[model samples]
Target chain A: MEVKLSLFGFGNVGKTVARVLLEKEAFFRERYGVEFKVVSIADTSGTVWLPEGIDLREALTVKETFGKLSAWTNDYEVYNFTPKEAVQEIDADIVIDVTNDKNAHEWHLTALRDEKAVVTSNKPPLAFHYAELREEAEKRNIPYLFEATVMAGTPIITLLRHGLRGDTVGRIEAVLNATTTFILSEMEKGLDFDDALKEAQKLGIAERDPSGDILGIDAGYKATILHCLAFEPITFDMASVKGIVEVTPGEIERAKAKGKTIRLVATIEEGRIVVGPKEIPKNSPLAVESHENVAVIKTDLLGKLVIKGAGAGLKETASGVVSDIVMAALMMR
Target chain B: MEVKLSLFGFGNVGKTVARVLLEKEAFFRERYGVEFKVVSIADTSGTVWLPEGIDLREALTVKETFGKLSAWTNDYEVYNFTPKEAVQEIDADIVIDVTNDKNAHEWHLTALRDEKAVVTSNKPPLAFHYAELREEAEKRNIPYLFEATVMAGTPIITLLRHGLRGDTVGRIEAVLNATTTFILSEMEKGLDFDDALKEAQKLGIAERDPSGDILGIDAGYKATILHCLAFEPITFDMASVKGIVEVTPGEIERAKAKGKTIRLVATIEEGRIVVGPKEIPKNSPLAVESHENVAVIKTDLLGKLVIKGAGAGLKETASGVVSDIVMAALMMR
Candidate 1:
């Protein structure tokens, strides 16, 4: 099958997914007998359709110059397209949704309902509209992959989905945030809390607002997703959760003196979800690393299942997007 | 299709595989819509076949007392029956080759040749007869899985065979041997190397002779197998490499003072395979927790890929056996 990929975003992750597939094309075909055609790119910059191939260099040039594909007008109209129109009518095997969060963008919701194979890093769709999206995907037997949503390139959801699919997972515990963990690690090294936050932001490790990360909302969101996948699915509002911003560098110093480190922990126990900061002993596995690292688990008949990896990174996050595309292709097949 | 599973050895991994399958009989049918029947058992002691269904409890009971199915009188009589008489002749849909490593006896070779789906934790057969066995399975068009052969259920081979199949792996730097890594971790922690070796033996973490692990022979075996899978179809002897058994605790302490932790690193760079202890920075993921943890790569267009999990333990190892059985069933359908 000639795989046609309808990419829904052109951000760092979206671009990386495209590059990896194009760069490793031979490896895929020679080894797995799978191939892909990058037919489209859609983002705020604009939309471009290069049916046979999206000349990545040319596309980058076009987008960079005009700041939008819509501004680029040439005789290259062989497969000209728009974002919403592409989702509706593209003769593609999979529609990869890498769109940034916009609560009102109903294109993806409609695509899922229409049975398009979706591979995404966009969490809003799943976080807010999981039921409707999942129902439609199942009803039509198309795959809905969101590996990048929870943890980039890590197999926590999959470890439970396939590795322990039938077993009843009782509890899940994890250090699921890297920005805050990085902040905490830095604080341990004597950097003041405000300075540590600034350093993380300077390194592009934390968001500008840093509200989602420092407040623990991001970890809480990921934990909610983990809970849905690991056990029975449930809906939880992101508001009721408290973030770890309350914990300061002073607390970190106190803990380091006692041979401990402060880490943001997330858990689903006794049917309730929790996310916060905790003081851990020095020798524990959680104390072993710094920077964009994350680890968590599922407890069951198999014992506590643990997974740790790049919680966030340009490349690591992009890896998940590519993984989602791979899975999407498999589903289309 | 009636799925018949033949046990070539009623050992720990074999029993655990059977046990989980039996325990999850209803689950297997409900979730995957497949059923497994323990149709045969064989060991050096003797062989037995249960055409209808094996009294798994009774089989376990008898095996515990007699050390083999060959020693069970009723099972012996039942053994010589048509199903039993055809110990070598029994046509099974899948064969669990868990025999002790004398290259896991000829039964494994026979199982592979017969085109019966083969899943084994035993390293010898796969290590020595990889090409031939894989050739036979390919000719017969059946699945041959040995996830346990490398990293147990740690997802090592699965990543190559499926997940990372499209990515060209440049180097596979690994901490492959758990026992040796564990011993070294203890040595680095100030335990006398000899005393740590003794402690490992007492804890059943090290083999009686400990040559395979301490001498790096076992990890060498795994590295060879990984090389064949990741690099080219190649065979090389690992005996010539210097092993970790000679490292003293004083040496470990010295390395630690220099901010290093010891890990048995296995590397394949430009077609050469090397396995030995490398002192890592205090924060490398290679400073893994406990025994049986392994990390590896797919060093191509997408960069380094790492996997970590239990590389040993009966239940963890048996999970691979079950994965094989499931894949075999998928192929049969």
Candidate 2:
């Protein structure tokens, strides 16, 4: 059976996902016996519908040259359809939500209720409305995979969900945000807080409006999602979040003098979620440098399972979304 | 659907698996919607058959007291059957081969031929005849899962096979054998090679015949299996094996003086598999300490994904086998 995919975002991640799907089309067919086609793609500007599967190469070129699907004058039909309307209208097997829209909760619900499996890199719906979406997906017997939500392409979600099934997880200590970690590493190198923030922004690692990252909201969101998945149901508001905005070079140096380093650590233990700058031993796993994200999951049976990788990137996150698509397809069979 | 599992070993790992299955019966049923039954169990002494599923609690009690199924004079009948005969006769959906019998290759083939899915911690069959067994399992449309063969319960196999499906894997640097790693770590603490081996043996970390581990043969076998699964098809002999038996404390101290640590590293790069004590930076992922295993997987899309966890333990290895059973059952549906 061919898997029909409808993408609800046309940003860098969405376009990179499309490129990977197109590039690995043959590999998927030959290895996994899965044939996938993107039938529709929608962005903020417009929506393009092609029930017979859009030509990925042409769509990529069109999107690269003209930043919106509405500008494409190909065999596809362009329309002014909202994400909700696109989900309701698109006849596909899966809906991929990569848009950074915080209010795509209803769109995801509609897709799940319509019997379309949902794969996403977006975190808002999962952070706020995980229980409802999970209940809907369970009721529909479809997958609601968001592997790219936390550590980009790293397989932490799947590892915890499926790989370590028999083990009881005790605690999770993680560095989930890349921007905050990068800033702190720079601070350790004698750069002041402002200079570190400027360097991060210059490297495109931090956005102009870095409130979500610097305020610990992003890591709190991930912690909330992880809590709902791994431990129990919890909302983002319940987490005790403290960001790296208050971390000064003097404090970093003080910790360094004591053989410790300050890192933005997200932790979930005993039903308490905390995301803040914590001073850890220099050799601790949480003291990872630069943009490297690490999660140390303490389990009863397997000890601690440490996974580290890139926390944020266009292709890295796209790889996770595509892998989820393949997994969803395989599970669908 | 109820999954019927047959055990071909009554050793520590196998008994621990039974205990875990009995313990997590409700969790598996409620969470994964999976109901599993142990239909048959066999050890070197005898075999016990139960088509309608044996009482796991009683079996555990009897095995704990008597050390073998043959001594259990309960409601079940005991018969003297070879592992091969047991696999051929047992009416099971899956056969779990956990026996340390290195010559149980024919029994695995028989199980596969009899249309039973195979889950194992045993490495001999895979280290020798991976392609043949894989071909047979594929021909029968059954899963031949051996996640416990490499890093016990740490999610390496599933991570490489399912999680990292979209990325192109480039290189793998790993510390796979815990005994050698433990010995090396002891040597790092100023013990000679002989004294370190004696310490490992006293701690039950190394066996009396520790040639397989000390000679790097164990790591070589794992490298072979990983190579076949990840990179390409290759036998154990194809790998360039170097043991840690010749690694002296002098060499370790020399490396330590240079800010490096001696670790028995198993590497697969450019289709070459090498297992030997190598001097790595003190903080490298491969420089894991006692009983801890680490794998650094380099991929094109995700950069390097590092995973570290317990490499060897009865419960840990059993956890991997049980997880594979659950995954196989889920896939069967």
Candidate 3:
């Protein structure tokens, strides 16, 4: 089946996805058996779409020079319209919801009601209204995948959702946030918190404002998602756990003396939410993990299933987005 | 659906599988929507099979006492046969193959040909003829999943098979053998190679002969499986890689003092087969992974799909067997 997609937001993830599709367009159809067309791209700059189709390379080069796609002046029509209305009328098999809109709740309700299966790198909807969204999806029998929203390209969400359907998991302990972990790791190496934060910012590991990542809010949202997926009713919010941006360099040094690392660990204990910075053994999966590496999940039957890899990056995050798209495609009727 | 299974080998992995089925009976059915039942078990001693299904707990107890099922002297007809034949005739929806009969490739061939989907913990047949078996499975459309065969219960097989299907991977680097890695880790900790090997043997991480795990043959088999899933044609064999098993404790100490660890690594470079020991930084994912933990594959697209966990444990291996059973049931048309 051919997929006509209207991609919203041409950020790092979106650009990488576009590039990957363009590079492997032929290979995917020939080897893996997938066909996709990114017909539209919309961002805050404005919307630029080709009804017939647009060349990925040309659009990419234009965006690089002009800073935003709206600057590209071609024969393509510029239907200055809100993204919500545009998505409904797009005539697409799927909609790539990569918008910067924080109100993911609105997107899910709107796009899903239109019978358009959504594949996103967004975190808000799953964090806020997992139950309602899942119920609606079941009723509609449509797939809503957010593999990038949690662990970038790690497939943590899919691992919990589909792969672990039959497994018995008592709890999941994860260092879901890579930015904070990276900052904390650098801080342990004698770099002050502010300097580490600056380094993380330069590396594009943290938010522009850095508030969501620094305040533990980002990791907290992931915990909520993980809790909902692994346990039940992801009412567990990050507010329950103390955020880590306030931790001083002195405190980090104190912890390091004992051969420990301050990691943002999210776990379910007796069906309750447990999220905080705990002292993990240096040789433990969590401590050894550097940069944006995420690890440490213990299940009832499988015991400890430890995984470490890139949690966030242009390439890694794009990998997650691609995974969601593929999964939604597979589940399509 | 009730899954009547005829379990063979009655070894660590086999016994662990039986335990998971008995304990997680309700969880499996309610969660996965499938019921599991073990009808017959075979060991060298004798056979204990209940046409109606015997008590798993009592059967295990009987096996422990006699070292075989024949010690019980039950009134029911005892059919002494290889698990291969038992699978063909026994009324079973799935066959659990956890036997260590490596050269007995015919056993795997017979089981799959009989229309009974196989879930194996053994790497023998898969290493020898993965393509042939996969072709047979394609013709039959039954899932012959061996997630445990590579990184026990880490979902590496699924990662390669389905998770990253849409992406084109350039290369894969892995520490596939747990026994060799364990011995090498201990050697780095000041123990000589002989002492480290002895410790591994005592912990049951190493076999009595220890050739397969020690001489890199175990990793070789796993690499072949990875090659089959990742590359085209899959022509490499155990003889291809420059195997590493004879490093001394002094070398391990030298590597460690320089803030690195020595790991016997198997890697695929630009579609070429490569395997050997190399020094890794202290914070590398593979360096931090110790004991029975296994980490493998740094794909070009999906960076470090590192799965670290109990590479080979009785229950973990058993859980994988049961997982394949549930999948086989789900795949039923």
Candidate 4:
């Protein structure tokens, strides 16, 4: 059987996902007994449509050079379709949403209503409207997987969902955001906060608009999504978030003097959610290095399980999206 | 729908599985839309056959007092049947094998041939005959899951099998044996080797015949099983095993003086498997506490992933078995 995929957003993460899918096309077909085709792609500039199947290789090359899918002229129809319009109008078996837009909730709900399996790296829909989206997917018996939303492709979501069945989770403490973690590690080396932020920007670890990364909003979104999946449903507004924007050199030195390190930790325990900078022991799992994410999940039956891996990267995040695509394909079969 | 289960080995892990299943019966049915019943239980002494679901509460009570399923006599037929004979003769939808016997290969093959889904914590079948057993299960389209075989309910098997589908694994270094880990931690605390071994025995962490654990045979078996899951097929005989019996306190102290710790590490890299005592840095993922197991898997796309959790315990091992059971049930549905 063939699974037709409709993709939204052609940015860095989106292009990487396309490249990986094309690279591993033959492996999927031969091993998993399923073939995949990218039928439609929609980005900020325009949309490209080929009902039969778009040439993924050509699409990636065109997007790489021209930064838009509309520039691809390989005998395909192009239109100025917004992501919402593309999701509602395009006919595909699965929809891959990689857009960072905060208002993509209605588009996801539309896809689920159309009976299409949705796999996303975008956290806005899941963080804000998890309960509603889940209800829609469950009503349609379609999958709504967002493995790449939390910790890139580390399989934390899948592990909690499928592997730890029948075990009750007690609490979760995690270092989720990578940008702040990088800045904090730099600060620990005697660099001031502004210089540390500049270094992170030079290294391409921090975004051009680093407000979300520094204000604890990114980690708060992740905490909301994780809480919805692991324990119960909670919206993004319910979390009490505090970012690392207020940390000073004196605080870092004080923590070091006490044999501790300051890490921006996201904690979900006993129906309470908080994201802030906390001082923990130097060797604790939460005190990870720059660009590294770690989560320590306490459970009743299995004790404490610590999962540590890369929190965010282009290829890493793409790998997670591709893994979800494979899972959705298998489930469809 | 109710799924019929036949369990072998009424030991610590087995009884805990039964108790957990009964305690969570309503939860499974209401949440997952499935119910399970233990129809038959077999131990060394005899077999208890209850086609109409055994009383799990009573069975646990009886096993707690007598240490055998043969002593339970509410209203079930007891017969002298070997594990292999019971597996072949019983009409079950799934078979749960927790027996410690290292020669239960024929029994597992027979269960697969009988078209029964097999979930096991026993490593012998997987460590020795993984290729053969997997072939049998694939031929019949049944699930042959052994999640509890390696790390005891930590989700390593499921992560490799279902989660990291599009990623390529490069290497794996793990602390897999809990008994030796406990003894080594004690040795690190200035206790002599003999006193550490005695403490481990007194704490019920090591068996009376601790050759399998102290000699690295246990870790070697786990390495074989992990190899089969992650990379390719290989039997237990292919691994080069060396136990920690030769490690002295002097060596540990020497390593400590150099800011390192001696740990029994099982390594699988570039088609090679070895289990032995190696000196690693103090804060490495492999430097875990007593009774804690950690696996650091290096992948091409996802970078390095470290999973740490309890390696051995009654509840932890049973949680893995129950998780597998839930997976099998979902697959059946």
Name the DockQ score for candidate 4: 0.81
lDDT of 2 by residue, B2-106 (tens): 999998888888889998998888988987888999999888889989999989888888888988788887598998888888888889989999988887778
Candidate 4: clashing residue pairs, number: 1
For each candidate, give the interface RMSD after superposing the true interface residues on Cα: 3.6, 1.1, 1.9, 0.8
Error of 4 at B312 (Å): 0.6
- Model 1 lDDT at residue A149: 77
> Global lDDT of each model?
0.70, 0.89, 0.73, 0.90
First chain TM-score in every candidate?
A: 0.90, 0.97, 0.93, 0.98
User: How are the candidates ranked when ordered by DockQ, highest leading?
Assistant: 4, 2, 3, 1
Output the better candidate (2/4) by DockQ.
Answer: 4
lDDT of 4 by residue, A66-135 (tens): 8887787767789888777888788899999999888888989999988899999999999999999999
**TM-score of candidate 3 on Cα atoms, chains taken together:** 0.88
Instruction: Name the weakest run of 10 consecutive residues (lDDT summed) in model 3 chain A.
Output: A233-242
TM-score of candidate 3 chain A against the true chain A: 0.93
B-chain TM-scores per prediction: 0.92, 0.97, 0.92, 0.98
Q: Provide fnat values for all models in the order shown.
A: 0.03, 0.71, 0.47, 0.83
Per-residue C-alpha lDDT of model 1 across residues A158-270, encoded as one tens digit per residue:
55554543344677777777788888878778888789899999998887899988888777778777777765466557424666667776788888889998888776764
Give the chain B TM-score achieved by candidate 2. Answer: 0.97
